[model samples]
Target: MVSNMAGGQPPWHGTEPDAPLGALEVYAEQAHGYLGASGDQLGKLAGLLRPPVLESWLRSLRGRVDPMDALDDRGLRGADLRRYLQAHPIAALMPLIDKLLVEDTAATGLMVVVADQFGRVLSVQGNDERVAAAAEVGLRAGDDLSERRIGTNAIGLVVRTGRAAWIHGPEHFLYRMRQITGAAAPVHDPDGRLVGVLMIAGGVRVARPEILALVKATATAAEMDLLLTAMRPGQRDAARRDAGRPQPAARLGLDVLGLGQPQLSIADRRIPLSQRQAEILLLLAEHPEGLGADHLALLLDDSDLDNGTIRAAMSRLRAVVGPAVFGSRPYRLHVPVATDVEALRAALDSGDVDSALRLHAGPVLPRSTAPGIIDIRDELRVRLRIAVLKSGDPGVLRRWTSGAEGRDDAAAWTAYRATADPETALYAQIEAKIRVLDRRMGADATRMQRFGA
Candidate 1:
């Protein structure tokens, strides 16, 4: 999309992954530098970021968010969210949202998220798995995507400038959130009052120049729907109506295994979580039956912690996670919590070792020492090792043996040897490593026997 070029704040357009549309490489590189730059260096390279993104970046910087801070972005939820939704004009537009954006895009694998003028997400509707993926990254209903909260996102940009906009991957302010790309448009009520922002989040497939147009079109449709729905009989005027829309909301991913750093991805942001938080969350996820506060406390720690302490901890966690996720009768998850662990388990159970290997990023929460976490960790590790050994595929075995967890695994190395032709150098190397391990094991056994004496 060419620069329309008019006012100080120009009417914005869309984004493409690469040129003949725009200089994505140049802008992305400059964004990286701009985000890293110190005070004076920041102004020096101002022109490169494209005025819209730079302005939003400035607003984001002025706001509470730090580009480098771990994103803990949240929106509204529970009773408070229900009240807000009921009162907001966007509430009437949900049917249109469900029909035009959510249902139409279901098979296309895109996601639709609606946010108020403040950029706090109102509703997220789409394919079930896609919605779950979005939730993992803090992009669910009641989560804020405002420039002040998450920084330089498509939704927040539209709110900042009151125009249609698209933000590409690296254009995002938060560092870890650079994996996402999205396009958004502002929805105006029939009276032209700013209703909210509609965003479509997805992968690079959404980076095409037409994405903003699609967003704009859907946003316009939402606006028109508000108009028609608001009109009583034959009311025909711009003043009679009310609305908001998205990026694909589609490509959501939760990574608990990558480098053992657990993060949630929705749209273009990856909200980071603490290890303890991740442990409690994943444990809750494991037990669909829901653990009681006492049992939950025991699972979280070996010590006999009181329910009050657990409740306090749960309260703090609930603030970060929002209220709709957990139920009180028994501490249970109200939604499907997908993780690399579950994905890997599914893959392994289906006898798909290749998929399991791809999903296994070392052991789950490698540093976690909680008994429940340790239990899951050990169980998953053993299961993965068994699957890897059973595969007999040299490439799969090589991948397993290459990891730190499996580097000294004698069985895996032996399996690799069995799969390889004896003449191959790889086979010889496996043999050599196994011999070293055997010698080490024998020496350790001898030392143990002497100690027993």
Candidate 2:
């Protein structure tokens, strides 16, 4: 019957009356005894505890998790943090979660938490007093509630099992958490992929079996709302675009333009790529004829790595990108993959400077130092800069100069000075920068002459 509860249906429904409050109390007491028992006594106590709670406890013991350890609240911060908060598919569920769970339970000794698929808490909404109390235990936005991080909590369990879970009092792996009860249900996207978990936690004063139904119903409503929103006219086009046409394998897209970390998008999932993986994929895409392990290692700037090391890396990449996407014999992409670097090159080749600028995300894996990657990265930067300067487009020049890449670019600044309107403030700024550059170049020339270069 865990499945019944997971499906948003109470197991007791259409059967005998619900388990009495006394039953939960007894379960909590037994769980406490099990928690306090020594290694030898644990074997005897196991038979008395509920199967799910007992299994969870065993897992905690196997993992060697401490029952008194403080909770972890670390996660994404700054712009990277903002991006996840804004672009996550579960973002649409916030209002509904607030209305049904947070507001409804305010001042009732309860708190509502919403977390991403990885069990990193995205938002926490609840009664002010209860929220403060929860924060004392590190329960708040950006907190990681994964079972690996916090042991056997309901939010982490729901995320791990994709099932609704209710953990009361001593069922919690952490002794400090035993004063509360938690009920959580997983939220799925319209495509039926698990997106996040919605959890309600309350002090012992509000513990009740009915809380399970409330959490499940709220999750169901949030999912329904997500589906309905996706069906709306404005959202339908985007949904369709995201779904794409069915292909033999998911298309891979890489963005490695500038200073930002490179990201790989496989269908709807966008994952960050390690520098080595990015270099390998970029090389593979550049050489559709494929590369042997030796050549690939050289291209990766690691000549000492043997074939086995390369194979191990490829295996790890395969786990993320899928086996169908990578071919053996000669390592290369077996399926079609698109990258922003290629998009920019194509745009520039076709004389579409605007499109090229738009496609240029940042720099080609700016942190990468591999010889091949450096060549490609430098080539792309030079080509784009030359094209932008030659195009005589003020809009393009302005965009380039305004960004981090062009902030001190002498060529871009000179181009802007030549093309910009004299009446404009930008022209004055460019003029000042040109003077600064001229003086610097003059100083460099003097140094070279004085040093007999």
Candidate 3:
């Protein structure tokens, strides 16, 4: 049996004067009763479960997760899984993990499971029999072991809490996982950010307090290996120099153009942004001088919202994009953000019509309904259209007139008519389109006059 050398009292105490095993059994029973009972009964039975475990259980309850639900094994597989492993920062630690845990515990019916920061298991290794047994419950690679999917467990808890966690049989919130026990520790990159989780899991027979320490030590060693690998012979000098100087903040690429959802990319990691956050970021990007909370609220919504609401939203955004990128005082980006809209504007300002046409993906945040976003979108559209119409290049005018944005634009058709060869069929097409637009405008003007009368 593994000794409890970490110096904390065990999670449970038996009511019947029995040994540790019997006490654990009684504790498990009480925990189950507590979970099944109403919120009022939790206070009375709180002592039966560890503080961390109780907190996890409460979160699970809030999420409306069922304790008896089967584990969800949904994630990248085959070529996608291989590609993910190759690009993941934790890939370098796989050899060390295999050496320390997989090889050592293979014959002992123990499995070493490694998961990304999101609690998606990337790899699982051990003895054939044990590995197969673990797979029966969906503990293999490409499975989501997050608390939201599988209820409270060591892997999910470590990812959520960013600390070492231990969960033995009966302590697990899931009835199906009651026969298993596990210890998990968060793996960190050289900069001390959580990169993944390293866990050693097995049947209850092999469960021991010492497993937590083992997993912690292994994770630390793997991190050291990764740090050294990053500072190889050629990069040692540069890495040392970089370490001495303050590192530059990472850049965020915001793509708000077109009808598709806006995407935010930082360090090659791309994530989709909600329309509200996209609008806020776009406005902030436009006004580098920054805007106060009241102005931001006015731009974001017509309804009245206090500064606190905006502050809370900014806080949540900072958590995702990092504080270095999203700044507070007046509300502006601290780090440089490159947006497609800005790129197109720059190309146009430089009088590079060809480059500007190439850069313009579509209207900026076309589907956005925010008042500020609408204003900026219209301004950009008008500026680009005017710039293209003023350019005398037949090729540039032809490209613009053919696209959806310029198809019905009267100015674009007029520019095409002035630039295209009179003998060409393309010139006839442009003339026909101009006549159609003229008729549409005349009908609209007549309807407006009738309405006024």
Model 2 lDDT vs. the true structure? 0.72
| Candidate 2 Cα outliers beyond 4 Å, as residue runs | 1-40, 71-83, 233-453
TM accuracy, model 2? 0.51
Cα lDDT tens digits, model 1, 256-334, are: 6756578755323566778877888888877868999888887888999898988887887676555656787698876
Per-residue lDDT over 132-226 for candidate 3, one digit per residue giving the tens place of the 0 to 100 score: 77877767776667786577888989888888887777777787788777889999877788999998888765456677778989998988886
Order the candidates by TM-score, highest first. Answer: 3, 2, 1
Model 3 lDDT on a 0 to 1 scale: 0.73
By TM-score, the best candidate is 3
Please state every model's RMSD to the true fold in angstroms: 17.7, 22.2, 22.0
Candidate 1 vs candidate 2, lDDT winner: 2
Q: Where does model 3 exceed 4 Å of error?
A: 1-19, 236-453
Candidates' TM-scores? 0.46, 0.51, 0.51
User: How well does candidate 2 match the true structure, expressed as C-alpha RMSD?
Assistant: 22.2
User: Model 2, range 122-198, lDDT digits (tens) per residue?
Assistant: 77777787777877776667666677556788887887789888777766777777767778889887898898998
Candidates' C-alpha lDDT = 0.70, 0.72, 0.73
Error of 2 at 167 (Å): 1.1
The TM-score, computed over Cα atoms with residue i paired to residue i, of candidate 1 is 0.46
Q: What residue pairs clash in candidate 2, if any at all?
A: 257-362, 257-363, 257-364, 258-362, 258-363
